[model samples]
Target: MKRILLAALGAISLSACAQAPGGGQAPGATASAPVAKPTVAAAQAKAGTPDARAIEAVRVLNPKVKVERVGAAPMPGFREAIVAGQVVYVSDDGRYLFLPGSGGALFDVQAQKNLSEDAMNVVRKQLLQTIPRSERIVFAPTNPKYTVSVFTDVECGYCRKLHSDIAEYNRQGIAIEYLAFPRMGIGSDDYKKMVAVWCAPDRRKALTDAKNGRGPTNASCKTSVNQQYDVGRRAGLTGTPMILTAEGVEVGGYLPPAALRQALDKLAAEQAPVATAKPGA
Candidate 1:
């Protein structure tokens, strides 16, 4: 099961990388800034706790890189730090930093579980929730059995294909909440088009038209396109049609309606609460 899961995720990641235009950075690319390093005294003051120490270790490597959050990792003697939306582990004593591929991932051999990916899933879930449903362009069924958030680009081919099948997905009881993620960056034509779509009187129709190559009508409004793009970036989106489960798990890239429904059903089953019987019964 672990191997199958990893293979599926790997294929999806590759697909996303290939679909992204303008050679956008990989998922979880570090967002660097021209920030100055903390003084020794300041670092010392904040290094009393394990979280601070872990954060300090990452800062010591490159002050320009942002360290968003730090917490205890599932691995013993290490702390998980969310640096620029990527998960990196630092030694509890602030000596070592374990990047995903560099030093290998944290896995539970006994349980066949990838702890590192689990941590990242939590981060994705939290970051995704920060954008409320009101801010998104939603295409949902009257009664949805599953709702998936998608980071989408207006001009991406795969994204358009997914949108074309939007009705099929809705028929399959899958609600799709679309968030703008213009691969060409903010202020680009793609961004403008998405803004137009979001600003349209009927976003669902406007989005469908745009996806079908009708082009968005000329209009402007105070839309959340920029904010949604930022959130997608922080959530490690590398391409359009980046589908994420309600629990923030990246099942894979574009899937046919039936395949998508199957995947969602499997996920639902896995996440369902297990029934426990009363001892006396």
Candidate 2:
């Protein structure tokens, strides 16, 4: 049931940004207050280029899928298109549509995943900003290479293991921002426990101690726990130790600090597409 609700939200988020994929932007949508132009330019770029014929082709196959014109490629002559909230490249003629993923010759599988994140850059940035950094228990480095938002549960073994390795992860230049997501659901004991931690005088310390099996102060007040859980749900997070990379890599479970850094570096490299020389001679 949770999965179904999440899928529905995902669809709605995409449809809300009819011109943009995953609600990054809408057609002719402008801010009422003064905003930077770079933000505007990025929104326009990420919205992609719409191919009416290609969209028609997709609709002819599956009428349920939504299509949007995102943009062109780093390499010329190829217009990037998004179908059903996934990234794909289409020829200038709009006759050939290329679906990117693993197990295919035409598209790079890892690159496809990266492309998905690329298309969602604006959405991730906006979501990140919506949550105030001060509200999070931040484990940061002096010069952090990458930062991740982690949705965690106190009783989960993996979450405990992840907390134990905090020093190692920080040493590897990976900062962690913790969000509460009690697996027992809202209004449960676990949920109340999390609320107590957030309502504590020192949220960061309370979280650390709670993960370490220390008791938290019993307190109650308005908090971001509910809102954070909602965000986690929207991001498709289930269970504990769900991590969101600064570059929009979303994954469940725990990863060792070194492995986590390598994963992030790989994601970064894929996102930064370099021009490759074509064979003509």
Candidate 3:
């Protein structure tokens, strides 16, 4: 899952073209910026609607970038712009823009992308409701404080590390819901093994047994196992042990219970601050 997330983000970063102000002989625009300004009507339409404006702004800024769609973010006055494989953000007035960064260092572009993704988290939260709870392997508490969906693979070493500390996660008010995503796609031994575990009468025990190196007895049963795979795919997931928070935050790999708890708390506390206009009349 880590590889997939990194790869997807990388692809998006590569697709973000340099935004050059004005048309013709601008500082950054492949070879050069165009000489003409964006159409007046297009700018007005984009400005009136945050979503529409963000889309139009990207097109005007970089005609080479192929934008597929535009939508509202979790916060008001913010817009999410999707350009083919990449995603970006634009302010309501279409004045500010952000892109993802490259390399291990978090550049200006990466910081902007993080802010944008944070604002769009609600979209991911909505997807959780589409799947029924019964179909999931739930590690729920009587009075749950927090819930997280985890895409796990039986064979992954870090997954075992997470399972080993399952009690700690539970004690921290973190309820874990397991979803299958065989690192190796169907036809591999790992995939076949996970299927057997899902088919077992006692799902919890079957998973435990499989993780302990004992292959589950071959069995057949209707389950939402494949559905989980599809969900991962749609969410741009391509690997195992993908952890998703209820608030729509995604942590790609294994995290100690304490660290995970701390991260969640931080996310919960950081609400978007209201932008203030100038005080002078």
Candidate 4:
């Protein structure tokens, strides 16, 4: 039932300012000037509105799915909505729906940005915040410069590789917070293993041991593994070793310690507030 709904919301071709594939700005191209926002008249002219029909359409698709906010989509005829924690677009008449996942992305050619990715980043950051720091298995230096949350599966090779370099990451002032994302699904052996690791008296060591093939000791206790996995799903996670920066931008999977540090530095610079002269001083 859920699969059917997701399929109905399957990705649509990038619209609005985006051009056809291979027709827009070349890779590494940057816009010379900021894109102007739509004028009041232009905004009012857009076709779609988050009307009752659009909300009803989404509810019809997934009766139990939570319909959060419904607002203007970048595309002229569609309305963007947060449904069941994922972003989806519905047409003005409420007949069509689109998802920006499974290799499909909504892009802004002129801005050199993935609009869909931007929305997902916001969702990821918000969902991640719901899981308190105490619930995550954290490995960090005494004074870390940056912290990243990783959605990992114990049996994933690259996840193990990332853990193997955990020391180097710490040395580089990068803190890692581990969240369980068992690719094998809930109640599977892998999920049970992660639960055991989370239940261990020493979660950090248990996670490391599991990653290193030492295997998690059999145990059972109150754990947030299920909650973490649900959050990962809502965050649009499709694979393990999914690394997210503090601001919720996914840097990619399995970056080496040095490369990870460089990525973090770049992100920090991008997010840092720019300085302006005070009173022409």
Highest TM-score against the true fold, candidate: 1
RMSD of each: 12.8, 13.9, 12.6, 16.2
How many clashing residue pairs, candidate 4? Answer: 0
Tell me each candidate's TM-score: 0.65, 0.57, 0.58, 0.64
Model 2: residues with Cα > 4 Å off, grouped in runs = 1-125, 273-281
Global lDDT of each candidate: 0.76, 0.67, 0.68, 0.79
> What lDDT tens digits, residue by residue, belong to model 4 across residues 138-231?
9999999999999999999999999999999999999999999999999999999999999988989888889888978467899999999999
For 1-281, candidate 2 gives per-residue lDDT tens digits of: 12321233234322333453465556789857754222112124422333444444444444555655445544456555565566556555444445544311132222222243445555665676678987787888899898899989888999999989999999999999998888888888888889999898887788889888784736689999898888777665656788887655574479988888888888788669798889993
C-alpha displacement of 19 in model 2, angstroms?
Answer: 35
Compute the lDDT of residue 85 as modeled in candidate 4. Answer: 64
Cα error, residue 276 of model 1, in Å, equals 2.3
Better of 1 and 3 by TM-score: 1
Candidate 1 structure quality by residue, lDDT tens digits, 18-100: 44366767688897886542222223435477678777765655566666766668778987766665667777777666666
Which pairs of residues collide in model 3? 1-239, 1-240, 23-34, 23-35, 24-33, 24-34, 24-35, 46-53
Ranking by lDDT: 4, 1, 3, 2
Candidate 3 residue lDDT tens string, 89-185? 6777776665545422211222334444554466667766566887677776677677899888899998888887888888888898988887887
Per-structure clash totals for the candidates: 0, 8, 8, 0
Which ten residues in a row are the worst by lDDT in model 2? 103-112
